[model samples]
Target: MTTKKETRTFNIENLNTRDGGEGESVIGGYAAVFNSPTEIGGGCFTEEIAPGAFSRAIAENSDIRALFNHDWNNVLGRTKSGTLQLSEDERGLKFEVTLPNTSLGRDLKESMQRGDINECSFGFIPTEEHWDYNVEPAKRMILEVDLFEISVVSIPAYEDTEASVIRSKEVNEQVEKRMNLIKKINTTLEAI
Candidate 1:
């Protein structure tokens, strides 16, 4: 079975633009924040990216692209071309994109500078994840991912809520089972 791609968006932090050496505009910001819990699927569950989640992908030199609004046709920069650089720091996945001197690129630069666009997103396929059922809303810790692309977005598309709800139900079942086992043990001890 083929793995499905997922996208997560965060409000842009430290987003800024500067003039490039060749008179082009360059944008940089944190695309993802590490250790921050985000409620997903309308609170069906919460998710956070573990530190180093993108380490393997970046070290392997993945050819990730930078896009506008997650649209392929609106390509802004690319890792293969050295226009897009990805790295991980204490904050999260940081990116710098040298915007091309095209209409789309120019428009994006202007919009970003005007504060009309202030969100960043990344697309990936989860390679490793862990779920904590002890929390009220099950927490999903994304440990590793196959990084694909990052985008500057206006609105973020969330994961499917139905699937999240199903996962939450499964987690609840496990929690209930554990609680039942603990109760049985307590009862047995009382009978002794």
Candidate 2:
């Protein structure tokens, strides 16, 4: 009948990677995270390539799209949408998600497309470039772009071991409540 809440607070930091601060949207920008909650561990954050930045990067970086254009009949599309690539070392992974799937979309898919949807590059380089949402590698990176969910645990450096146990109990309780809520909603819908 009683519950305890987590003391941890998540601060979502958003950054533009491709911005030159030139005051022109055409000048473009790259939206990547430079910070994350300390509990996420060191050097971990998410990287969201600006909406058109990936295609633009592919357009500007090289003619990588040209190859796909020729192969797929110019459907080269969003250079990053539904795209994911990992370094040979497997320590980092970069991919694109539909804009509607990310935090910024209000989650609407109508605006989610190759050009408008965000090109996200997620990585887990502990001592390397961290754009928010970066965390340790989850499963091996897949080739196609699809919705993704990753989970990571961070233990405070100064926590008493018992505190972690208590925190864990709170987490489990929260998960159970969410599940129960979903179950109740499903039951109500069935009755309708």
lDDT tens digits, residue span 84-146, model 1: 999999999999999999998899999999999899988888899987655656678999999
Which 10 successive residues of model 1 have the least lDDT summed?
156-165
Candidate 2 residue-wise lDDT, 1-192, digit = tens: 122211221111221222113321111112222222232212221122122212323333321221110122322123344322211112222222222223332222222222343232221111212121122311111122221121111221312447646655664455446556667887899999
On TM-score, the leading prediction is: 1
Which pairs in model 1 have colliding backbones?
none
For model 2, the superposed segments whose C-alpha errors exceed 4 Å read 1-90, 93-159
Collision count of model 1: 0
Which candidate number maximizes lDDT? 1
Give TM per candidate: 0.82, 0.22
Candidate 2 residue 79 Cα shift, in angstroms, is: 33
